[model samples]
Target: MRPCPSPLRPLLLGVAFAAISPTALLAQQTAPIVLDEITLQAATATGTIAAPAQPYAGGQVSTRTRLGALGDVDVQSAPFRAAAYTEELIRNQQARTLADVTRNDPSVRQDAPAFSERDSFFIRGFSVPNLDTLYDGLPYIANPRRSALEGIGRVDLLMGPTALANGGVGRVGGTINMIPKRAEDQDLTRVTTGIASDSQLWTHVDLGRRFGPRKEWGVRGNLSWRGGDTALDNNNAEVGVAALGLDYRGDALRATLDLNASKQDLDAPTSLFNAAAPGVPIPDAPDGDINTANPFEFHDSTHRMIAGRVEYDLAPATTVYGAFGASRYREDFLTSNYTITAPNGDAINELGFNPQEIEGRTAEIGLRTEATTGPVRHRITLSAAYALNRNNRGEFNPRLLGFPVAGTNIYDPVYLPAAPDLSGLPRADGLIPFADLRSRSVALSDTMSLDDDRVQLTFGGRWQEIRTRGFNTRPGIPDFPVGEQNYLYEDSAFTPAIAASWRIRDGLTVYGNYVEALTEGPMAPSVAENAGELFPAVVNRQREVGLKYDLGTVTLGASLFEIRQPNGITDPASNVFSLSGQQRNRGLELSAAGAPMEGLRILGGVTLMDAELRRTQDGAFDGNDVPGVPRTAASLYAEYDLPSVQGLTLNGRVMHGGSTWYDQANTQKVSGWTRLDLGARYAVEAQGREIELRANVENVLDESYWASSARGFLAAGAPRTYAVSASMKF
Candidate 1:
């Protein structure tokens, strides 16, 4: 798994024949005619020309975005079930995170296992923590455990429950926004290099600029690095990233600023799924890139962020906006915790050390307006938001230091013995003072607009608030009671939303939505029986209907959904875990992205869910079936383009999922899997710059299954890997 050298193939074929020669296409058409006569003498000395960040059609897949605040609208008028993935599908799928751009999202999955240093998901079936991602639309500033897509540009994905558009503290199975990367008006520099599949090694840099005299000042920058070995076995990893962005545009003022930093280190990482001893039967899944972690395990993380935004325009249809963001996160983990004593995979392992630190802040303010009364046509918006989070955790235990760490057998593997000197433990920076979280929201929306605009309705509401506190950094054990007793908890809710769309004509549309989501509840764990109870805060309801079509070059969509929530286990004959469970999920979805002809292109989707679990605890998990819900899922991706090799292009992708259930009484299941991927790209143009080359192979058939599950762990699929990249632009 470490090959591919040979002097980099004659330096990539001498830069692909000096980038399609022809004098580099006549010096790129005379350098844009000497930069358009110095941009027409600076546009006649600044009359104006700053409009540039809205032109993405160079490869389809973009139906407008800003999903979740209903801002940039149009995905057939946005009535929910969003999708957005562009950056040309994350650079034609050479994706480098956000789980590789959600692996072409089919309602997303992957709850663990994928170079795990943190990055979890389950989108339409709950659980999406990575600290609840969002950025640009601001909310704690992205960093859901190692997220780096080299300065991202679009990744919308809004499937359900956003509590009236991002505020009531997300995740009733959706919400993920990351849009950054500005500074365009076209002066850029790009560089990229890559490899991965047991050897790693990648590099990237991108820069952009625009200045004064009407280009309205802007700048962008990104840098990246990745290092060594990783398709498992003895694992190893390293990463670093940096970003900077700034913007300004006048005529009514607009501004932006962003900064970021990242770092990650891993060695023998990947280990999680140790809880199968109640009757053992969950083993089978120990191959694919094996490494039950612990070659002196390690995992580290660091991140920093800053964000800002401002907008103003007090007339021609009024507007005002403000946003702020902040973030700091740190992590350190020592792995190995595998407990599946036999089912052919025998396991016992133990080695612990957890460390964490997090701080976040977010803010938002808004006003938007447009009006008309007698003939409809409104469009109002009012907003407010606040979020704060703090967390610090610590743990250390090598069997409490008597040097006890032994147990292994995930299909025969052992290599322990190098970690017995805790240095007298107590690290994680002398941790103490565990949780604190707060979220506040206020929202109002309107969107009327009738007949002339072909009906569009939208009404929103949000008045959320949630506060939480928890402490007791392990003090004298006994259900750990130190300071904060019943772990203070607070709650509030009011989420409401309604939506409707009906273009019913030019390119078709028909949408409907009803939303609600408000989560954060489920405490009481000291072995149940109401141990430190503090519940109340769980509302998740959604209903949707959709259809969209834009046949002028392909685009289609479909939807029908339902969701219900309420969960809080632990009863065992009155042992009290409260909230008395309940779960429901219903669905049907289908989607497609376009470029139906010349040079082909197509994005894909399919989902079919049904999930259940109606009431538990005394009914013993009632109708079962909701543990890692997966009643079918699908995805496809395609690309073509090659009229006799003019800069090549070819691609493929397919992914599927179906059987899933690993507890909650549904007798344990895990089958249903499929995966395939392939890729290629070329593109050229030399001395004038612009070059590209990409390659991909992801699980092309390595197939070792058991790829999804969450809560009841179990994650394995991911093996046949390979990637290549090359980029240039100046």
Candidate 2:
């Protein structure tokens, strides 16, 4: 932790107080503005001004989390489990993307590792699409593949299906929400320069200011650039980002706006989806530093978005809020299909090219009111949300027109050149119909308190509707019809939730909840006989119980949960896809965060999970463990200050992922693995400026292994990496 800056810090005791306070408005009223002047001007300044929950004791996690239409909820009082990685920790760790920040959670794992250029993840043993992430409480604004960490204030993770949380539902796994940064009350200008192992260089600038008589209007902006070769062989990467944030904090009204654009290009991109020849033993992982991609293989993506939100207090205890967001993601890739054939690493490769564009718009409005009726007090909320998404792709569909297969060796790979005169093939010009999706939902909830508010029970439900349609991009292919071969699915479902919490004593709370999530059904894979088939919407269920204890400077928590979801798979014998599968995951989680002592801080947790494929075709895989769901995953991150050195601190982290099967028959397996990371930072005041120097090394042991094998696709882990940077504030 750094010292308070300015000495005359803003009188921002809390967001609620600041909202109605004449001096400081907190969403312009919600967040805590406790940083002193100099500290406030630090490089990690956020763009948003509203935070209902302050950072917990350790400054790495928050005490409150967003609970769907319920809005910001105190952790102890909330029946769900969640984690929010703070901005302060992001800067110290030199995170580059969403995956880097979310690795702190034991229940979350990326299905694709570093260099994959995409950010899909597995939460509680279920696959989560990259397209379903939320930005500032709105769906579809974040980049579909990977969202940059620049200007992001917090990366929030809510485990379990959250269909009731938004119009676009994620898989039964979970949801990830990103909060954009807002301006601080104090004027700030901070710049950072850094370099990574091999040959990567980057720089970032953050600026914030407040204008208006009462400093109610504010602006924050960020610009960043990174380019050069990455740690992997033959990989060259380039990226650029620009972002701006604006806000207003008024006595009864508060608002914020954000605009962002970013682009990434990578040559010799890594492939995360590798298939093993049927009935063949999977090969051991190759050296992590080698490049298996051909010279011609590359990927390019661009992201652009604009989002805004506002709130108004009708009275002291009633508030109305609304939010809207729109975003676009453009993606193009020259890729291939790789299938490992032998244990010695022989593989076959076939080229595939794809180019696509996705766009989305979302909006939500709600009213929250607090009231009293006799001995019971009540908090009620009513909300409605809508989202629209459209996708465009090239005319060529790899599912129907795959290239002739070639050969390669995983141990000593071969790079093949692209065929000349590719005029007849599909290109990244994005000109054909792919899919369009529309979603709408309405929700209402009431929380009633009893017995002096010591015990509370709440019930809520959401009525959601989904309309989706997909078109055959390659109508010319003989396998498809002449006109657009169309597929459409329209459905509606109601998801209900009930939760109870009891504050047994000061700083201690116990809670239980039962929730249901409704989501769009799965689509048949290209390899299946029923390619492009769309299924009806499905509903998932979850039951959980938990407790939290706070010891002033420290906080500890534990929870047990069970979730059941409908699964879809292709019949091995018939090559047909169907929703004839089901999976249930039950887990126990323990977490801790805070500064147990004056100079030492710690954050981490452990998750023990039992995931089973309850029903499969002919019971072929019944009672078997689900692929990629580790039995035991544990992680710990700690920081300590040396009394001998006033402004210096050292930190380290250890992570372990338990062994698990990679196939349905419990055939292919990935061994358990452990990783270590170390870092340090120094802070000092010089020439009227606060300066910080930070350095970190990930995978200190340089271990090479498989990270995940969800959906029968193998994802390789990353190798050792080193990074260093310096930040200066003025």
Candidate 3:
């Protein structure tokens, strides 16, 4: 048994603060000269984006990634599959959140829009919450509902269960990790402003600099604000984001600190609850510009986080590191649920107001070292982690007054009157205990290489303990009194993982891995008799094999994977919900990213899925395709710089999805749809730097269709929108 690493929260914060305090007094955000193409190329060509290897051919992504205990390894060389999208890509795409930037990944999809209150998704046909996302390789720090992208340097996505890397129960579908930006060798002063859709306007400022004699201290900061009416009628949104990053790098010591805060407000938000009433036939989707929620309805969320890390090299081949993070999230919404009841667009709308708050903290300490034997080289790591989250909720909504329901039409939603003030209810502004989660883990692993490093094999295991407590919950129609309640659930497991990789030849590698994850049980729906009941934790497993090829200018990857998962389901006869359902997703994924040819760059992929139910209510739905799991999904986004026209580039993207069943019984399905988007950009020299103007038209044809039927819920697609922006570098 391996001993746990002591908590380093205090030491990590102290070291980082102490290292950057002196340099902060002398740092200059702006240098004398502007940033030019040559300087930009030199800055990126170095190790600014990735380690050892420069940015890939297209400069949109890097082949190297920071895998949990594995440290940094080549994507192809690592047994698991993953990709790290670069800041260059984020800037080009104008991505506002993780969902906006990850659209290029076929394995990842979301039912919500970028302007929505939450950012959630399905990676490999399994649900993933934004709260599980990581910041700087540590969890419980990123925003709980929506992750901001202002200070993010790279978005790394690892496909499949990563319990072996991130100890304790982890995401079974995948993991998204945001790498923070730091001051680069070259100074930067960039200002960008834009307008979107009918009346939205926004501006952003970015600054970076290095200080001290050896330029070992660095600082980077970003701030942005946006607000206006959107393409959807009656829908208005506003957002503010701020992020600051500090770091220090020496010959043997390195430390970093990151701080972020953001707030978002939305009125008459669309597509939050788009489910059709049971036994009601699916209705035709309204126009893209339609806003289903009433104009008086509103939703708002706020997030704040601070994190720090420090690492020191004890020897050339050995190192010690520690990380700590804390975050707070609060949400308030006076929204209503609208359910379609008939094909004629008739629906029932009910108003419900609830406020939620979540607080989380995580810390870790680890040691890594490398040793060699006569015939092999070994890299070993031992680490320990602790994470805790406490969730609280308000009891002002239905507990005191039953929310009333009204009839409406989906095609032409009748605006409702204003909601009553919430300040009157006692404790309406206060919060009651809802749920708490704590996870403690110790992990150790080793990677061995032989035969000139051509063949490699890795194996590891983690001992993890998960403790959960539950309190108050909103039950069925007639609300129950909200009171102090606490329920405790604890479990422990030893999860093992193994992988093997063979470099068949230069620029090509084949790898496979087997992994498992323990996931929190789903809450029973309000319609079930066991409403709000939490099922016992279940283990999810996956098996994957993949092949990779670097075509110099273009890189292509292919993989086949299988996942088995269990969930809670309601029994119609017994009216009880329990962990009696199982699902298996078997699929093949093909992806390509980079500059395949001169004057061109591409990033997109295709996914084919065979998701089916293995066990269901009394085996009634056995062999049926899993609801909302599309048979095929494909997207392609490409850019071409016209050889005849200098400083001009045109790009277009097309997304297509196959049909999917909407219910477990597979009685009906929503047809697939295709969308097209176009954009252009022009760059010219200005003040010794560069100035770029960009424009884009999304949903070119103004197609109106069901965006997603995930979990049997139907969310309508957003309308066509136009955006244009200009950026200047100094």
- Cα lDDT tens digits, model 3, 1-730, are 1111223323433432332232321221122222341111111111112222457988888778878666777776878889999888888877778987888888888866544688888899987778888888888778988887878988999999887776454578899889988888889977677778877766677899999998889999987776678888888887778899999888668889999988888887765444453445577678889877878777787888999988777765667888899998888887766667777888888776768788989998888776666566677778898998887776543644665678888898876676666665433236887778788888888888788778898888878888777776554424444554545678888888788888999889899989877666666654455655665566888999999888788888999999999954454346566775788999999999999788899998999999989877678889999877898999899999988889999999998878887767776567788889999988877447576778989889998877777754677777799888767677
Reference-based TM-score, model 2: 0.90
Q: Write the per-residue lDDT of candidate 2 for residues 1-730, one digit (tens) a residue.
A: 1122212122211222322232321111333223242111111111123533588887988877766567777666676777878888888888988888888888888888588778888888888877888888788788888888888878888888776555435678789988888777788887677778776767777888989998889888987777778888888877777889898998778899999998888888788544553456667777777777887777888889999988887765667888999998888777666777777888887666768888999998888776666566677888899988888877765655545577888778887666434567655454676778788999888888788778898988889898888887765656665337477888888889888999999989898889898787777865566766778888899999999898988888899999998877655446577887788899999998899999899988999999999878789889999877899998889999879999999999998889888667787777778899999998877657677778899889998778887766777788898888777777
CA shift at 347, candidate 1, in angstroms? 12
Note the clash tally of each candidate: 2, 17, 0
lDDT of 1 by residue, 220-299 (tens): 88877667788888887877788898889887777888999887878878766644533456666766788877667787
**TM-score (C-alpha, index-matched) for candidate 3:** 0.90
Candidate 2 lowest-lDDT run of ten:
38-47
Model 2 score (lDDT): 0.77
Full candidate order by lDDT, most accurate first:
2, 3, 1
Q: What is the lDDT of residue 253 in candidate 1?
A: 77
Order the numbered candidates by TM-score, best leading.
Answer: 2, 3, 1
lDDT (CA) per prediction: 0.73, 0.77, 0.76
Error of 3 at 63 (Å): 2.5
